[model samples]
Target: MAELEAQAPTPERGLAVRGLRLAFGDTVVQHDVSFYVAPASIFVIMGVSGCGKSTLLRHIIDLQRSAVGDISFDGQRLVNAEPARRAALQRRIGVLFQSTALWSSMTVGENVALPMQLHTHMRAGEIRDQVAFKLALVGLAGQEQRMPSELSGGMAKRAGLARAIALDPDYLFLDEPSAGLDPITSQRLDALIMRMRDALGLSVIAVSHELPSIFTIADDSIYLDNQSKTAIAHGNPRHLVEHAEDARVRAFLKREPIDEPARATTNEY
Candidate 1:
C-alpha cells in the first residue's frame, strides 16, 4: 500500500535506508532490505541482473515509492519531507545512468552547465568556469564543444560523469558506469573513479554486474542470491572470492567472463 499520501524525509548528511520493500500490484520486488552508506566511502551493490539493486537505489534517491520502510538522512527522515526540502537535498546528490544520459543535441559543456543553471543563482561566466573545471577533472577539458554523438563510448561516459559531478555533489550514484566500454577504457574509468573519490571525498554508490570492476574499486560490496531470496555475502571482493562459504559464491567466483570476445578460455590461476 502506498499510504494515502507521500511524506518527505527530514535532512541529514549521510543516507540510510531502513527495511525498504517495494512491489508492483502483486509481485514483490524487494523484501526488508536495509543498507547504510557512510560519507566519503564507495558503497557498491554487486549482483547479477534483476536483484532489486536499482529499485533500492531509486528509493535512496527518493525517486521510487517503498511499500514499507523509512529512508533517513543523517538524522532527518526523507520519506516525509516536503518538496522544497527534497529538492534541497537532491541538489547535493548526483546520479549517473548506465547510458550516460547525455542529450544528443547538447554539447558536453552545455550538459554539464545544465545542473548549475537549474540549481544555483551563479552567473553564466561562473557556470562556464565550473563546467570547464569539471570537464578537466574528467579528462575532457577542451572537448566540451563535442556533442554526445561525437564521443567514443568511454569519452561519453566520462562526459556524463563530468555532468554528474559538476554540481559538486556530496554523494554520487553510478549505475553500471563501465557497462559497454572496452577493457582498457573500463580500467581507466575505474582509476578515474578512485581519483574522484580521493579528490572530492565523494560517497559513491555503484551498482554493477562487472566482477572485474567490482574487484578494482570495491571497498565493500553486497551480493544478492535470487535463488535463496536473500543477500548471501557482504564484504571485500578479494576476501569473498577467496573465503566465502556459499556454493553460489564459489560458482560465481569460478565463472569466466563471457561477454568479452577478445580472448579465449584459459586456466583460472
Candidate 2:
C-alpha cells in the first residue's frame, strides 16, 4: 500500500467547518458539527446508515445551506458569501457524486471538457489536450469517445473522477466513492485517490462507509452518529477502532455488534 507523503507547509490552504448544522424544514439532521481538513490531506466523513453523511457533503459544497455555522476554504467564506464570491469559491472545489452524474448523452471527453469550457476561455484545442491529460491521470486514457452508458461501473466512476479534477481544483469531494464495487475495484479506486492527493496536492473530503477504503486512504476521519445527530468520534479510523471512547463508534469501526436494538433502517441522505 502506498502512503501519502506530507506536503510542504502552506498556511491557510485548507477547509474549516465550525458549528455546522443541517436541517430540512422542521427536521434537523445534525448540529454543532465542526471539523478541519488540512491541506493535501484526505479527510473522511463516516458513520452507519442514515447518519446524514451525504447530507453533510452537500452542505460543505454549498448545494444545501446549513442551519448554523460557517464553512471556509483557504480563509474565504463559503456559507453566506455574496453570490459572486460564493461562486468563485465553489469553482476552486470539485465533486464526484455517488451516481457519477455524467451526462448520458455526452462522451467521456465532453464531460471532462465541460468544466474548463464553462469556467475558462481556453481554446478548443487546449481543452482537448487537458481532457486527455486528466483522463490519463485516472488510467482512462483513450476512453474519450465512449459515452457514459458504454462504460462499466468502474469506468464510469473513473470518468466521473476525471471530470471532477478537470479544472485543477484545490479541493476534491467524493460521495460514497467505492460504493457497489468489488473489493479489487474498490482497492484500485482507493489507490487512485491517494495518487491524486499526492500528485495534485488536493485536500480531499469523502463521505463513505466502506471500512476497507476508509482504513486504506483516510488520513483523518469523523464519525457521525445517527441517533445523536452529531459527530461522536474524530481521528484516524484505525486509531478510533481501538481507542474510541464511544462504544457505538468503536462497534461501527470494528464491525462489532452494537448493544442497542437496531433502529428501523432509513435511506441515508
Candidate 3:
C-alpha cells in the first residue's frame, strides 16, 4: 500500500475557469462562467434542472467541448493541453457517474481491476491483491466475486466509489452522490466520502441538487441559476443561506431540501 500511496500523483491545487462557455445551436448551456475550485475542496456545483452545471463539469474534465474560455488544472490548460500531457493529467483524476456505471457482467474485483489492467502491465495476482485492498478501503472487504445485480443501491454506489478511489486519484469528480440514495444511505455515503477524502488526500468536485449533501461536506460551492444565466452565488453553503444578496440565491436557499428515501435532517450536517 505504501507503493500505491507513493504512486499517487503530486496533489494539484485549484482549478481555474475563465470566460467558459458552451452552447448547443441556439440553446446555450453555460454562459461565460468563471470560478476557481480550491484544492482538496469538495466544491459543490449546484443548480436547477437546466442550468448547465453538469455541462460545465464535463468541460472541466474535457468530456465536452466548450465554445470558449479557459480551463486549467494546476496551471495546465485542459482546453489547450497537448494530447499526451492531457492523458497523463487525466490519469490523476477520477469520475463517478450518477449511475453506479459498473459492468453488470463483471464481479466486483473484476470491475475495480479494469482500469489498472488497461493502464498498466501488472500481473494477475498483483492486480487481485490491489482489488481486494481497494474494496476493503471502501468497507467492502471479501465481496470480490459478487455480481453488480446482487448489490443494493447503496452498495452499488459504494462499489462505484471503490473503483473510483482504486487509483488513489488526486482529483475526484462525482456527478451526484446522493441522487437516488435513501437518507440513511446518503448519510453513510457522506461519511465515507469525507473519510476517503482525508485518507487519500483528494480534491473533490461534487455536483448535486441536494443541499443537505452540499452543506455536510462542501467547503465551498458555485450555484448556477438557469434564469440568471450565471452562477448566482459562490461560497460556503451555510453562509450563502443567510448572507447572499441575490433574490434568486435567497429563494434557492430558502427552499426545503428534499431527497428520495427521506433523509433524517435537511441541514448540511
Candidate 4:
C-alpha cells in the first residue's frame, strides 16, 4: 500500500515514481512501476494499448490514485503534500493531452493566454507578449486570431503545446502527441519537441504507443507489460531494440517493418 508519507524528493531527480502499483476497483492495472526522469531529459512511457501507459501518467500527475507507491517532483512529495504545495508543484508542470484539449470557442491566442490568466497576475499586455512568443516558438506565429477549428491537426497540436508552456513550466507531459497526425506532421512535431527541450531545458514525460515517435524522441523509456502487470523493459529504445533479453520485447520491436508507412525514412546510408 502507498503510505501518506511525504519525503522531499532530491532536486537532481526531476520526477520520480517508486514502487508504484495501480488498480481500479478490483482490477489491477500496473505493478511496482518505478522510474526516474532526470532534468532536461525526455522520458517516454510506452506500451501496447490498454497496458496502463496512461494510468501511470495519471498517477504521476496526481489525477488518479495509485494503489501503492510514491511520486515526487523537485523535492516535493505529491501524494501527501498540502493543497497549496501540491498546487504550487503542479504549476511547474505542464500537460498536453492526447486531444490537444483546446477549447473550440477560444481563439489560439486566447487559449495560450488562459493559463497565464488563471495562474498569474500579469497584465494583459504581458500575457499577449508571452502568447506571441510561445506561438512563434511553436511555429504558429501570427495565427492568434485563428480558431481551433481553423487549424489542421498538426497546428492544433502546436497551439495546445503553446498553451501548455504559457506559464513556462519546468516539466512537460505529453500523451500520445503523434496520434492521428500524418507521418510528416508527426515527424515535425517530434522535431518541435526536441527544439523545445533544447531551448528551455524541459524535463519531458511522454506517453506514446507510436513506435517511430518513441525511438526518435526518447532518451529513456519504460515499456509496461499487460501480462505481468509491470514494466518489462526499460532503457534507450535503440539499445532495447537491439539487446533486450525478453522475447516479448524483441518481438514487439521487430513487429514493425522499417519501411512501414508511418516510419520516417532517411537519406543517409
- Candidate 3 at 21: error in angstroms? 0.5
Per model, state how many residue pairs clash. 14, 0, 1, 0
Model 4, 16-74: lDDT tens digits are 88888888877788888888898999999987777888878888888987646888887
Q: 155-222 in candidate 2: lDDT tens per residue?
A: 99999999999989999999999998999999999999999999999999999999999999999999
TM-score versus the correct structure, for each prediction: 0.87, 0.94, 0.88, 0.92
* The candidate that achieves the highest TM-score relative to the unseen native structure: 2
Residue-pair clashes, model 1 = 14
Report residue 14 deviation for candidate 1 (angstroms): 3.0
Error of 1 at 109 (Å): 0.5
Question: Candidate 1 — what's its lDDT?
Answer: 0.79
Error of 1 at 48 (Å): 1.2
Q: Candidate 2's error at 154, in angstroms?
A: 1.0
Candidate 3 residue-wise lDDT, 124-178, digit = tens: 9998999999899888999999999999988999899888876778889898889
Sorted by lDDT (best first), the order is 2, 4, 3, 1
| Candidate of highest lDDT | 2
Residues 73-119 of candidate 1 have per-residue lDDT tens digits of 67566777798988877888899998998999999999999999988
Q: What are the clashing pairs of model 2?
A: none
Q: Tell me how far the alpha carbon of residue 40 in candidate 2 is from the true structure, in angstroms, after superposition.
A: 0.3
List pairs with backbone clashes in candidate 4.
none
State how far residue 35 of model 4 sits from its true place (Å): 0.5
What lDDT score belongs to each candidate, Candidate 1 first? Answer: 0.79, 0.90, 0.80, 0.87
